[model samples]
Target: MATYDPFRDLDRLASSFLDTRRGPRRMPMDLYRDGDHYVLTADLPGIDPGSVDIDVDGQLLTIRAERTLSAGDGVKWITREREAASFLRQLNLGQGIDTERISASYDNGVLSVTIPVSEKAKPRKIAVSTASDSQVVQAHESGADEPQPIEQ
Candidate 1:
């Protein structure tokens, strides 16, 4: 026997009503930096690959997808929890992100976007020179060394 939870049902009803009023719902996503690039993954189960659209406009990235359900002829619907709907999400990618090189792929109902960091923004190590090299650089920078005063 299943226990009845009135509060849970009420909450679900309220959520569904609010979602209907809000139009397309925002899909959940996860973003993280990996090495020289950032990866963003969004959940889009039951969404057709051809229906997915991704756009980047002036540092703003947007993702949209649609989900549709079809009922066969002479089929009666009993309880329908999943309905035709749309999902949308947008993110503002700040500076240092190579927007021109951004790429996206979808597999197994998950959408992944790879955003590479610009070359200028990548961390690089400066070569350390030997003491002799440092002295040469110092001499060149000073043009000519002045004679030091001899202490008595």
Candidate 2:
């Protein structure tokens, strides 16, 4: 009897199956955080900017695009293939998200989104005092007479 490793077989099977499924493959995206903002970038070529819509409903961010094409009326036989597809991507943003400050822009087949963190989530710099005017006072113990003014 032999034990099976799910990961070993899972990768091989999933890769082959996904490879066979063609037509407008789901694009890959990169997410990174800098300072107090998080950025999400995705590649969506051959898609019109007018047809793309980005929205954040609750904590989920969704992007959808629709495309259409037309041919002449003189065609005898038709072999039509759909060039448009509804791509739904939902991201569950954890706590500390500033939903009101979310913004998105699409240009040159790329979509960029900047999500600002809540006010409390942003880092703040504390001011440090460097002046020598501040002084520290010491207290004397019960028996220790308030140290009389040092002898001149």
Top lDDT hit = 1
- Tens digit of lDDT per residue, candidate 1, span 13-35? 88877765447888889999999
Model 2 residue 59 CA deviation (Å) reads 1.0
lDDT of 2 by residue, 1-152 (tens): 98989898889767765755544345568899988999998887767788778888888887777555665688765544344555546688888899999998888878888989999878789978865556655666679967543322
Which sections of candidate 1 miss by over 4 Å? 1-4, 13-19, 127-152
Worst 10 residues of 1 by lDDT: 133-142
Report RMSD for candidate 2.
10.7
Which has the greatest TM-score?
A: 1
- Candidate 2: segments with Cα more than 4 A from true spot: 1-25, 75-82, 125-152
Q: Against the true structure, candidate 2 has what lDDT?
A: 0.76
Q: Report lDDT (CA) for all predictions.
A: 0.87, 0.76
Provide the lDDT at 131 for model 2: 56
